[model samples]
Target: MTNQIPAENTLSIEEVQAAFAKSYGGLVGQLTLQNLSLEKQVQSLQSRLSDVEEIAFGLKRDNANLIKSQVTLEAEIAALIKAGPTADQIAAQGKAVIDYEDTETIASFAAANYGKEKAAPVEAA
Candidate 1:
């Protein structure tokens, strides 16, 4: 059972096509605008991602340098521990012995020079 439209009620093929074209054009214009907006959003996200990647790379490089420095410092500490203190360091720990005459001479010199200033030389005319 096929239903048939009356000739008076039926639309012409050209009218239907014109209506479809108008609808299709409107939809296409909307889709085009949406596509452009999405593209811009994607580009903005890509730019932000690039900046984040650069920051991450710098942080990774800095972390590597810090780790290397830490390793170098640890090695130096280990070497110093194995080598032990120098002779000068050991000698510095010993008791210092000062002679009585040297102490008296230093005391006398300081007492003599205390509050005394050298006289300025006369300027030539």
Candidate 2:
């Protein structure tokens, strides 16, 4: 014969302790799962931060290079202003060679008359 315990029956102290222990175990398991999830999120954030740092470093380097190039260009411009018109500038102004010829020609001049107008040699002097 199965004897049914009444719903109002009181639990002993050991039974109550066992019930609390079981509930506590479940709570601990849930807390562990939450901790693991939070740790994963932290790791993801750290990885994204590293990537952003790398991009910032690259941008910094590029900015430095651009500044250096700009400085160099300014210096070159200053030097050009100090020096007389460069060949390109003179060409742009349409100045021509001494024996101006409207037509273009190519020729190699010989040095056969070199030093002819210099002072005569000791024997001739």
Candidate 3:
């Protein structure tokens, strides 16, 4: 029954709904993309932290094991020296086994590698 086209500002009910839907869809898409990027970064950081923690624990355990073995070996070496041979003779035999360039200027490599942590003080003290 209308005789002329509607004005520019006038729109059908369906067109208004469609336009709103398009704008909402674009906003959702952009937010989703941003959230995905943040999620990836968070996952990467978590994985790196896990690896660092594993490495730290492994080093601590290995250092502890090395110190235990070194202590046992030192005890065995001390016992051997005390059995009969002079300390110098025992040390000379050790140098033959481990090729030390300087016999007198001995480096305590084990002591250097395994750093000591001070024990917690007793409450009474």
Best by TM-score: 1
Ranking by TM-score: 1, 2, 3
Q: How well does candidate 3 match the true structure, expressed as C-alpha RMSD? A: 19.0
Give each model a TM-score. 0.63, 0.56, 0.43
Q: For candidate 3, lDDT tens digit of each residue in 16-83? A: 99998899999999999999999999999999999999999999999999999999999998898696
Model 2 TM-score (2 dp): 0.56
lDDT of 1 by residue, 69-120 (tens): 9999999998888656653433333212123334434443333434223211
- Summing lDDT over every window of 10 consecutive residues in candidate 1, give the lowest-scoring window: 116-125
Of the two candidates 1 and 3, the one with more favorable lDDT, higher being better, is 3
Candidate number with the higher TM-score (1 or 3):
1
Candidate 1 whole-model C-alpha lDDT, 0 to 1: 0.68
Question: What does the lDDT read for residue 111 in candidate 2?
Answer: 15
lDDT of each: 0.68, 0.66, 0.70
How far residue 39's Cα lies from its native spot in candidate 3, in Å, is: 2.3
Off by over 4 Å in 1: 1-3, 83-125
